[model samples]
Every structure is written in structure tokens, then in C-alpha cells.
Target: MAGLISKVFKAKWLLLGIALVLLLVWILRPFLDVFVYGIFVYYITRPIKQWLSRYIKNEGILVSVSLLMLALPLIILIAYTLLVGMSQLMAVVNSYGLTAALPSGPLTNMTTSFSQLHSNLTSGNFTLESVTDITRQDWYKTISGYSGNLPLLQAIAFSTGSTIVDIAFKLFIIFLVGFYMLKEDAHMQRWFAGTFPKLMDEHNRLLPRYASAVDADLQKLFFGNLLSIVFFAIIAAVVFEGLSIFAPVPSLQIPSPILLGILCGVSALIPIVGMWLVAGPLFLYLLISSLIAGTLFTHFGYFLFMVLAIFVFVLTIPSFVIQPFMARGQVHSGLLMFAYVLGPLVFGISGLFLGAIVLVLVTHYFGIVVPEMAAEGQESHDFDL
Candidate 1:
């Protein structure tokens, strides 16, 4: 009777423990991407951190420096993309003679009003009357009707601000997670091994060995990806520059084709959609520029040919031919491609990470671990895998 009561108590606690774990999982489901990305960031920076540890004594400072270095390229990419993108788009529009869309007379008049208003404000003549006078101008009235969607614009701004905040929060979480992992990963690994000793045995070796192998391959895969990106960017830049020689109009040629090429390479991180993010906008810019300039009839053939060359030489050929060789020894080209392709098709965005992970684990286990285990594998830190 006493033993039965003890068993009942243990069962109840175990059930409660499971319930709490499930609750925790449910709470964290929304942040799965942030956590996965954090893990990715951790691995990518781990080597650098290890190297830095030789000189940097403080854990916090080391992690910060590593992350900053990693972020430098991203920050530069975004800032340059925005600054140049705006100028390029506007240049195209101006070059194309979009005068039919907005008359030059009204714009010149509007600019004069703005200049006068600025001068009045600076000279301390700022008042409702002055503002009203500027708004009352004929040119201002020409656009006032189009600007009637003030409430809608306000809502959009609010939504955009909220999204930025959410994204900022997620990035903080990702870095925080990475920081802690860098600081305490060794401790955590030791604790994990001690907490589950029997897991060292053959039946349990299945998971750890498989995981270790996958981890190694993933590291190699990422390194290979870096190399691929570099090569792709170089190749893309050259191709785009070469194609520019055929442009009938300057606007039809890519502005800073090298930067666009680098961005195309970086866009691979976006997965599934990939280079389209860079190339799509570019194609659209060209099409709109030619259309508005009334050069479409004469130049449409060039536009079509340019896009085809980009897709064939810069995109399609690289994926199947170049990248496979880049990742040759690390991952099977066919398998890697399939993972990248079918992953999104099968499971949506998360599938991008998931598919690669699953591929590594399965390939490593069946190909290596299973064979060794079946032959009675020896124990080592290698076995600790």
C-alpha cells in the first residue's frame, strides 16, 4: 500500500512536469525563428570567439565585438542599398520623361512654395497664416486632393513603427541568446552529458553521434555557402557589367552593378525567393524606365534579352553548376539543392532551415553512425558524438 502511494505521487509529478514543458513550448512557438537564427549566429561566430578568447578576457566584450563585425557588412549593405536605390529609381523616372504623370510646372511651383515657407520659418515668421498661405497655393492644391488619405497614411506609419519595434525586439533576443551560449556553452554541454549518462550507450548514441555529425557538416555547409556567395557575387558583377555594353539608354544599365551583384549573393539567405528579391526590382526598374520614356517599342527586345541573360548565366547556371562544386565535399550537391528547393515547397519558410538540418542528420546517421554501431563501435569523445 505504501509503495502504491509512492508510485502514484511520482506519476502525478511526472504528469505535471510534462504539462509545464508543453506550456513553455506553446509560449515559445511564436519565437521559433528568432531562436533558430540565434543558434545559427552562435555557430557562425563561435570560431571567431574562440580565436578572440586568446586576447580578450571579458566574455561580454568578445561576443559584442564578434557580433559587431558580423553586423558591419549587413549594416553597410542596407544603408548603401537604401541610399543608392532611391537615387537610382528617381534618376530612372526623371530620365524616362514621366512628365505626363506629374507636370513640371506644378512641381517647380511647389518647390518654390516650400523654399519660401522654409525661409519664412527660419526668419521667425512662422505662423498659421504663413502656413495657410503656402498650402493655399495653386500648386499645393493640385496635390492636396491626392494627399487626402492622411488618416490612411497615419495608420500605415503606425503599423510600420510597430513592426520595426517587433523586429528590434527579436534581434535583441537573438543576440542575447547567442551571447549566453558563447559564455556558457561548454558548461551547458558538460551538464547535459552528466544529466544523461546512459545516453552514451549504443541505443542512445544514435542521437548524440548523429547530432555531432550533423553539426560538423552544417559548419562545413555554412563555410561553403560563404565561398559560394563570394564567387556568385563576382560572377554576377562581371555578367551584369558585360551586359551593360548593350544598353541603348544609360538608365537601362544597372547602376553600381557590383553592389547589386553582392546584394544578389546576400539574398540567398532569403531562401526560395532568393535572387528574385534583387533581380525583380531591377527588371521592373528597367521595364518602367523604357515604358515611360516611350522607348519600349525600340528597346523592349534589349530588355528581354538582358533579363534572359541574367537568369540563365547569373542565376540558373550558378545554382546547378557553380554552387555544387563549391559545396562538393561538404554536402551532396543534389541533396543540398533538393533540400533548399523542396523544403520551402513542402513546409514554407521555416523549411529553409529545417530541410537542411534534417538532411544532415539523416545522411550522417544512416551513412556513418549506423554502419559503425552495427559493427560495435568503440567509445571515445568521438563516440561522445
Candidate 2:
């Protein structure tokens, strides 16, 4: 009877503890992005902290220098890139007269083209070959006169301003939270480990190990991503600049090579889409412009094709070669791909990190921890019997 009462009391306390944890998670839900960003900053700068610790020995000073060396430069670079890219984008819009290109002009041209085709068909002069030729010529003519409307430009400008403000705020929060996390990393770890019930020896041992595994995975994901971004950015800039300088015609040039290159690097983070998000629009523009200007089949067209081929190759290498090599024994490529793609869909931008954390925890528990716990449980059960 006494044993039963004791068991009931313990179960009630366990339930209460779980409730408290759930409550804490609820409270922290809104700031999940901040914490996730902080963790990323923590892992990325951890090596620097350790290296500097050898000489400095003061944790605060070590963390401060590491943050300044890594985080500050990174933040500044990102800000500068964003500002330059926006200016470049606006320039491209103005140069292409995108702000003046209305659907009405294109639609009217398309309607005229179709009317002519219909007249030819009804006049008993239509053949498949003629129809195709006429259609192609009409499209070229229509695209040549393209100019974006004012309303669209106004919308784009408004959205761009709002997006810039939002990104700036988020970045500020990320850096602010990250600074403290880097400084008190040791204390944070101790606090986390100490959160579990002291009586549960298994949990106390397993929790830290699990955390270490997660940390290692986060390091691979973030550092690999950063390296890929830098590599792709450099490659893209060189390729675009080379084409711009040597292309046979000025019409074949890529507008704002730096902006396009940075966008290409940013696109590397998205799984299957990759750099095509930047390359696709650029290629389409070049193709249309070349066709309209009767530059197709010329040296300019050849150079444009070369640019496309090179960009495709660059995009392919990361997915097929670099990523596989980087993730070789750490995490499965398929799982990482899923996390990269689905994370943003489910958890917004921060999902990339959050999804990875969940993946690591789930995989660790099922692949390693669960089995060990089960084996121990079986042994204990046999001993009791």
C-alpha cells in the first residue's frame, strides 16, 4: 500500500514537470527564431572562441573578439550586398524600361499578330510552317516593344522598402540574441543539462550527448552552406563579368553582375530550385532581347548559350559533388534535402535551422539512444524476473 502511494506521488510530480516544460515551450515559441539564430551564431563562431581561448583565457573577451571578427563582418557584408543589389535591381528595371512596360502594349501587339494569322489562315494561304514562322516573328516583335507599367513599379518599390525594413529588424534581433548566447554558452549548456531530474541518471548522461550530436550537425549544415555561398558567388561574378566584357554585342550583357551573383549565391540555400531562380530570368531576358534584336545565331547568341551552360554546370556541381562530399558521413543527403526544402514552408525562414534541429534529435533518439535504452530496459526486466 505504501509503495503504491509513493508511485502515485512520483507520477503526479512527473506529470507536473512535463506540464511546466510544455508551458515553457509555449512561452518561448515566439522567440524561437531568435534562439535558433543565436545557436547558429554560437556554433559558427565556437571554433574561433576555442582558438582564442588558448591565449586569452577570459571567456568574455574571447567571445567579444570572436563575435566582432566573424559576426560583425558577416552582418556588414550582408547589409552592403543588400543595398547594392537593390540599387542594381532598380537600375535594371529602369534600363529595361520595365517600369513602363504595360501588359496593354504587349496584349495589343499579340492581338494584332493573332488577327493577321487568322486572316492568312482564312485566306487559304495557311500552312503549319507558315503559321510557326509567323507566330515566332510576332512574338519577337511584341517582346521588342516591352515596357513595364507605372503601377507595377510603384508596387515593387513599396514591397522592396517593406522587405528591407523587416530583414533589418530580424537581423538586429539575431545579432543581439546571438551575442549573449556566445558569451554565456558554457552557462547555457550547464543550465540545460541541469534541467532534467537528477534522479534520472540515464537522462543526465544522454541529454548532453544528444546536444553534442545536434551541435555537430548544425556546424556542418551552417559552415557547409556558408562555404557554398562564397564559392558560388565568386564563380558567378567571374563568369558574368567575363561575358559582359567579351560578349560580341552590348545587348547580350547581363545587367548588374554583382547583384545577380549575390542572388545566385542566396539561391544555393534552397534545395532543388538552386541558382535557377536567378539564372532563369536572366537567360529568358537575354533570349528575348537577342531574338528581338535579330542577334540570334550570331556571336552574341553563342556567348549567351555559353553563359547558360556554365551557370547550369555551377549549379549542378554543388548538388551532385560538393554537398554529397560535405555530408558524406554526417547526415543523409535525402534527409538534408527535405529539411532544406520543407523547413521554410513549415516554419518560415528560420525553419531551415529549426527543421535541422528536429531532424537531428529524432534521428539521434531513434538510431542510437532508443536502442541503448531498450537494451538496458530488457536487462533490468530480466534481472527483476
TM-score for each of the candidates: 0.54, 0.57
**Cα lDDT computed for each candidate against the true fold:** 0.64, 0.64
Top TM-score prediction, candidate number: 2
Query: Candidate 2 clashing pairs?
Result: 99-148, 100-147, 100-148, 101-147, 101-148, 101-149
Q: For residues 183-256, what per-residue lDDT tens digits would candidate 1 score against the true structure?
A: 88889878888877787654757667766777777765544564466557667777887888678887678765
lDDT computed for candidate 2: 0.64
Runs with alpha carbons beyond 4 Å of true place in candidate 2:
1-19, 54-57, 72-173, 191-200, 226-297, 300-329, 377-385
Clashing pairs in 1: 208-385, 209-385
Candidate 2 lDDT, 1-385, residue by residue in tens: 9999989787997889899999999998867776787777776677778788889887778888988888767646644444444445445655678745422322222222333333334455334665556677776664443322333334433533334676577677777677787787778777766775563356437766766776677777665664456457667766787777777787787778766876687577666777888888888888888788878667754755666665666566655756552431256655765775456435544565677777777877786688778888898999999
